[model samples]
Target: MIEIIAISEAHVESFHRALDTVARERRYLAFLEAPPLAATRSFVLDMIAQRNPQFVALSGGDVVGWCDVQRLSRPIHAHGGILGMGLLQPFRGQGLGTRLIRHTLDAARAAGMSRVELSVHENNANAIALYKKVGFVIEGLQRNANKIDGVYGNVILMALLF
Candidate 1:
């Protein structure tokens, strides 16, 4: 059985592995690979310290997906957060994305976040659709915003306001 739960220190390494797997796909996240383990550990610890919303999908004690909402640092923008999430290839198309995102977003809302935003590659139709289904709306499009492997792609900005 798959479970979605808040991230904890014990889950950091597995979460890093899951992040690396998705990032190596090179078709979704801006990261082509996961950052160093130390850096990832620090990031996760900081998220926990700050009470940011971060969750992971666990299958048999291994992380297969994750979702996080990072609050902006500036005092004026503190009410808002940036959302990021991903799942392993095998886990896609199984509604895990919806489950992960909804859990994280609910945590964000309960933590006093008033807005959550994200940017998706235009080619990532599934992600865009998922975000829309979760109350996010396209705010703008940046033409040729990303150039991966010498190919340019547009980026769609989306946001959900509470």
Candidate 2:
């Protein structure tokens, strides 16, 4: 069974440790064919300190995924927020991604956010499909938004209005 829970300081070190050698390696490879990611650990830790939510997906007591929800500028964009998430490759295609997004949506609504936005690389068909399944629609495409292996990659900006 999978479970979702709010991350705490107690989980910070392990979370960072798990991600340090794994997520960074994959993302770096995707972006630059590199094997290390600089500053990602510190960034995640700082986000936790700022009380930006870090949710963990667990199965049998092992962390399998995570999603973040943070508030956006107010007044002009009141009740708006941003979301970012990822699941281990082994955990993908099992509907866990949908559950993770739904958890973030619920949390965002409870925190007074009426809209959520996210971006996915155009090359990531699976992620785009999952987001669409959860009601996120592509609002626009940012041209040459990312450079992977010296090639420009586009980003699909998507949003879900609550």
Per-residue lDDT over 47-160 for candidate 2, one digit per residue giving the tens place of the 0 to 100 score = 677566668888777667778877775678767777877776678889888888888788777777778888888888988898898899999999998875587888889999
lDDT (Cα, tens digit) per residue for candidate 1, span 5-108? 99999999999999999999999998999999999999999999999999999999999999999999999999999999999999999999999999999999
Question: What are the per-model numbers of colliding residue pairs?
Answer: 0, 0
State the displacement of the C-alpha of residue 154, model 1, in Å, after optimal TM-score superposition: 0.8
Which structure among the candidates has the greatest TM-score? 1
Q: How many residue-pair clashes does candidate 1 contain?
A: 0
Instruction: State each model's CA lDDT, in order.
Output: 0.96, 0.72
What are the candidates' C-alpha RMSDs?
A: 0.6, 3.5
Clashing pairs in 2: none
Q: How many backbone clashes does candidate 2 have?
A: 0
lDDT of 1 at 61: 97
